[model samples]
Target chain A: MIELHNVSKVYNSGGAPVVALRNVNLTIAEGEFVALMGPSGSGKSTLLTIIGGMNSPTAGRVIVDGIDVYSLSPERQADFRYEYVGFVFQQLQLLPYLTALENVLLALAIAPTPRTEKIARAYEILAQVGLKGKEHRLPSQLSGGEQGRVAVARALVNRAPILLADEPTGNLDRATGMQVLELLRDLNGAGQTVVMVTHDPQAAACARRVVHILDGQIVGDTVPAPEHALAPAVLPISQPAIEPCSNATERVQ
Target chain B: MVLLVVGLAIGVATAVALMAITEAMQADVAVKMDEYGANILVVPKANDLALSYGGITVGSAAYDVATLSMPDVERIGTIKNAANISVVAPKLLGAVPLMGRPVLLAGVRFADELRLKRWWRVEQGMEPSEAADALAGARLAQSLAIQPGDEVEVNGRRFRVVGVLAENGSQDDDILFVDLSAAQLALDKPDAVSLVEVAALCTACPVEEMVEQISHVLPQARVTALRQAVTLRMETVGQLGRFAVAVSAVVIAIGALVVLTTMLGAVAERRQEIGLFRALGFRQRHVGRIILTEAALVSAAGGALGYLAGMGAAVTLAPRVANVTARVPWDPVLAAAAVGCALVVGVLASLYPAAQAARVDPTVALRSS
Candidate 1:
């Protein structure tokens, strides 16, 4: 569980300070699928960043898993993020020199896992993200959708419970975005707490609860269908094949 | 290790070649002056004309043999510094042809002068005691390709070589030693000499003034001291050393440039790698150490190789050639110092690159695609 009590985040570029999060307060309990829905400037990304411990709130306190996440030192914040949160960025930031599996394995360098056991864990995670046989390939050799899948594998490589995705499909087409969305939805359904921020409603629909914001304030919190979602999409093809019902409104998420 | 070796090769060869050539020139000139270590020489003024301008006219005349009678030799021997002096007033020198090469023939009162000028070391046979025979320096025998039993035609006279002096590469190595009467009669000049040398105490003061004043006192004669030649040789050697140092400096500059370029590019290429390391919990100093280590490795190799190659050049290539001697000066120290300095310089060169690598923002860096 994570909470931000009336948090406000501001940044100073040269002289003037710019406010990103303003008097915002929110909470998500354990194993919850929360989607932050807002316009481009609605501070949704700011809220997610604050909750992720990437940026500290200017005013309010942040509590996560029964600990004052911000009260911990900056170094401790990084350690906590590394241990507790998995991040899937708008751009799939895979290192160029590393293979797909090694990109995931990079997180293991800081893990308490034995060196001999890390490769097995990396391959397992890669398999879990529908990247079973593609571990040896470089990011450049993979498709956009596949690269995003690898990034997901990397984020979860350390087995971090709280997954934070900032526009998971911002770089993908509708078909690929659906595949990725279904993947995240499956992880949320499997008792994984996931906070995804997106401007697209369909993506937000995959979440059990959607928190909508306008400007920098939370305007509405809505409940959607099937509050419990799919389970971390185990390589999709394993599920029984279904007909392609293209109603176009099955909700892209 | 590879870089250190290459760099050492470059550095040692550069420093050694420079050092050996200069030392060789110095040694060559010094040995000659030492052989002429009679300390002082008094020659008749008119014979001085023949000595200075002797090569131009083969039979030019000035000083009469009658002027340098044994009485004058005795009179000059009475100086306070002359107590140990055995005057070496050889007959006039003349060129003889042997195997088509010119060789200077010397006629000396070797039996007496051997006491005053005893520097010559006999390497072969024995000194010429019988008349109509001669002693030759080892180099002179090599030039004529002659042995002790060999006979050489000199000024239309045949003279046999009874002995040869060891090689010192001095003026003594280029001339033949014979009896004064035999030399004077062979060249048809009687009781005269090209020059005279007087050995005296190696004491301090007035060597220049004594030679000048003493020669001034002697009628129609010129006196030259050995110190003047030594001074000239010493000054020449000093200049040559400075020239060697200048050349060594150029080599060091080139080495520095090579190292700088290599390290700079390596730093740039490794920037992302550095950031990767920093995010993995490595401190800035750790990043700095890696870079410095690379540089030290490169420079140490260069230094070691340079020293070995330099000494090799000196020892192998120097003596066999002209004006070069194998003088490996402080080789071990220079090699170690160059390598150590290369390490320090490598650390310094890494400073800027390390700083840049350290300043990389993990947040912004993770932002890139």
Candidate 2:
């Protein structure tokens, strides 16, 4: 379980303090697929980074698996990040120089595992993500959707319980984005807790629950109907795309 | 990396070459100074008498009443510092009537004189080795119109000229040289020597101390030390050593500056890569180790190549510049020291740049694409 208590983040912009997150409190349980929906500059990505222990909240305590993430020393915090969380950065941030297999192996670079075992685990993860035959290809050689799968494989290779993804499909077309959304849904279905930030309602519908934020404040929390949930087949012609929320006062309940 | 290696190699090469050249030059100068002749002069003690007329002194006359003889010159060899003596040539001087004119005559042992005056060249025939043989100076032979193998009468004794010496720009160019016993007999002063020239090996031994030792053994003679010659040789060698050290220091500083500037630029370009490593849970020390290892490898290569190039250049240049016959040998101690110095410089120069790489923020991964 992941819990955030009154987490607030402030940035100094040319000597003036700007607040990115304001008194945000949330909780995510094991095996949950949660989507954070917000427009640009809405602090949705900030919340995800804070949860992953990559960003320090101005005032708050983040507890993951009964351990306070911020209370550890910097070195211990790095170890905690390695053992507990895996991050899929925005735009799928695959290192261009590394091959698909090598990119996946980066997650275990500091792991105490032997070299042979690390290679075997990296190979297994790449094959699981549908990149078995293209493990030696560079990112430039792979398609946009294939690169997204590489990022997902890098995150899942560590086998951490919590996966934090920020705008995973922001750079892909609708059809390719749907493929990545399906991959995330499958990973979450395999008992992995996922916290993803996105603005598209179609992407949000793939998650079981959605949290909406505007201006650094959470406005609503909702669970969609069963018919609105993503299915393996193409979307039905009768079910139209849901509109994005406009204000903090709007709620699905 | 290539630029760093080349810069460091050039610095090491210059230092090594300068040191080799300086040593060769000092050795060459010592040889030349040794050939210039004796640094100590021994002469008979003078007796002075004042000549006056009607209370007005015409002049003062000085003569050697007690002349230095063969026994006094032999006693000079038994001194405490006798081992430092390299050559001792005794000469008997007199004036003899020859061809209706009084000519200066100097009698010396040819073997001892030849060894002390290594720069002398015989222009015609060979040196005088027999008691009745004589060697004529360039000016004296020309003025008398004497040729080699010609018989000349000195003090009613006939002697054959066997050789004529080349012009040496010294007092030897105007005198006739003969065997010491023959000159002593012709001048009616047997076993008398006017002066002695002593060549002392002074590289490690002091000339003044040797002069004092010789004086104690030959009390009837005056011993003098040539201070100007010794001072000149020492000062020349000292100046060359100081010059080599100064140039080497400047080159090493330039090499270090090149490494620091190039490494700083490399660190700036690799910021995103370093951030990725940090995000992968690598410690700051690991990042620093990577950078330092690269510098050390490059410096080691530079040091080895520099040593070879420097030694080759020293062997070729020493002969032409320093005028030394002996070639400079490859020194193993110098080779090791060169490589060690280069490694130390490279690591110290890269320290700041490595620290900057270690300080890269891991949050850069989230910000940059």
Candidate 3:
């Protein structure tokens, strides 16, 4: 279980202090897929980063798997994150110089696995993400949705128990975004705890629970209806014309 | 990375070239000194003054008469650094009437004098090898209209002219050289030498120490080192070496400064990348190792190329610029030292930048983009 106790973040820009999060407290259970929903400047992304150990809260206690995450040294925290958590950003932060398969292999840089096994594992994860034949393509050569799949492959390559994705489908079209959402739902159904931050209700509708935040504090939390299921449509990014069935709460942007 | 490597290469090349040229200059100077003859001059402890009658020299007046004996020459061989004594030749001088004209004659140990004056050339015949044989200077031979195999009458005694020396443009061009014993017998001075020409090899010795030793053995004679010759060569070669060192230091400093600035800029530009690495579980040392390894690799390549370039510059430019044959020294130790120095400079200059990269805050850096 991941737990947060009175998490707060303050940023000093220029000279004035800006509060990004204020006394935001939340907990996530194991094997749970939760979506954090908020408007802009609502600290939803900050909350996700704090949980992922990417950012340190100004004042809070973060406990991961019963171990106090913030109490350990920065080095140990990095090790903990590598061992237990993986991250996917909206920007598709794949290194431009590396190929798709190389980007996925980057997650195993510190993994104590044999070189041949790591290569095989990276290939296997890429194939699972529906990027089977495009492993050698650079990020610039891949389409937007293919790049997103590469990012997903990198996050899942290490097989970390927790996946923190901030705006995973924010840059994709409705059909492509739905495919990504269905992929996340399938992973969550397979027992990977995933915490995602999104503004689209259709993406949140796919999660098991939704937490609402405003002005750096959680205002609402509820379990949503299981209205979205894995689409039977073969939503390969290469066949963009084959649109998958949409969720009930799909919002047009 | 290219800029860093080029800068380091320039520094290493300049340093190695300077070293090669300095070595060449020292070698050339040694050869020049050898050609200039012995560095130490020995003479009897007496002052000779020409007595004049009506502004014309009538006779010679000496305050004291002292001479170096053959035993004194043998004692000179027992100096502290006896092995450094390369040449020891004693001379007996006198004026004798030859062809009704008074000409000065010098008696020298043929072999020792030949070794001392390595630059001397006999234009006609070989060096004087027998007691009765004489070698005439160019001017003296020309004045007498002499030829090899002819006999020169000196003091009613005749000596065979074996060879005529080429014009050296010095006092040697105006005198005649004969066997030491023959000259001493002709001049009526038995077992007496006017002066000793001692060439003390000072390649690794203190010149004054050799002089002092010679003086201790022959206190009756005045021993003097040819300070003018020694000082002239030392000043020229030492000044050139010091200048080379100063220029090399400046070049190396510029190289190091360029490396530091380039590395700092690279780290600053790669903040997000470094933060990502940290986020991926790389510790501070691991990040530092990455940067240092890159620097060491570039520096080693620069060192090797610079060594070849330096040798090329030395062989092609030293002769024209320094007027010395630049012998390219194939020294592995020097090459290794140059490369090691470049590595040290490159890695040391990158330390602060690597540390700054390691200290990048993952949260801020990740959010910046």
User: How much lDDT does each candidate structure score?
Assistant: 0.68, 0.80, 0.80
Over 4 Å off, model 2? A16-18, A28-54, A65-67, A71-253, B30-36, B39-118, B123-136, B146-166, B177-227, B306-329
Give per-residue CA lDDT, model 3, range A1-253, as digits (tens): 9999999999898999999999987888898888888787899998988898868899989999998888889888888878878888777678999999998898898788998999999999888878888999999998777788888888888898998888888888877777677777777878989999988766776777778788988877755543432211212112112122355243221
Question: What is the Cα-based lDDT of residue B243 in candidate 3?
Answer: 91
Candidate with best DockQ: 3
Per-residue lDDT tens digits for candidate 2, residues B269-342, read 77777766666566677778878998898888877777777777788988987767655757788888778878
Candidate 3 TM-score versus the reference = 0.80
Rank by TM-score (best first):
3, 2, 1
Return the clash pairs for model 3, or none.
none
Candidate 3 chain A lDDT trough over 10 residues, lowest sum: A231-240
RMSD of 3: 6.7
Docking class for candidate 3:
acceptable
Q: Lowest-lDDT window of 10 residues in candidate 2 chain B?
A: B52-61
| Candidate 2 interface CA RMSD, Å | 2.0
Q: Score the docking of each candidate (DockQ).
A: 0.08, 0.30, 0.39
Show what share of the native A-B interface contacts model 2 retains: 0.29
How well is each residue in B71-92 modelled by candidate 3, as lDDT tens digits? 8888889999888888898887
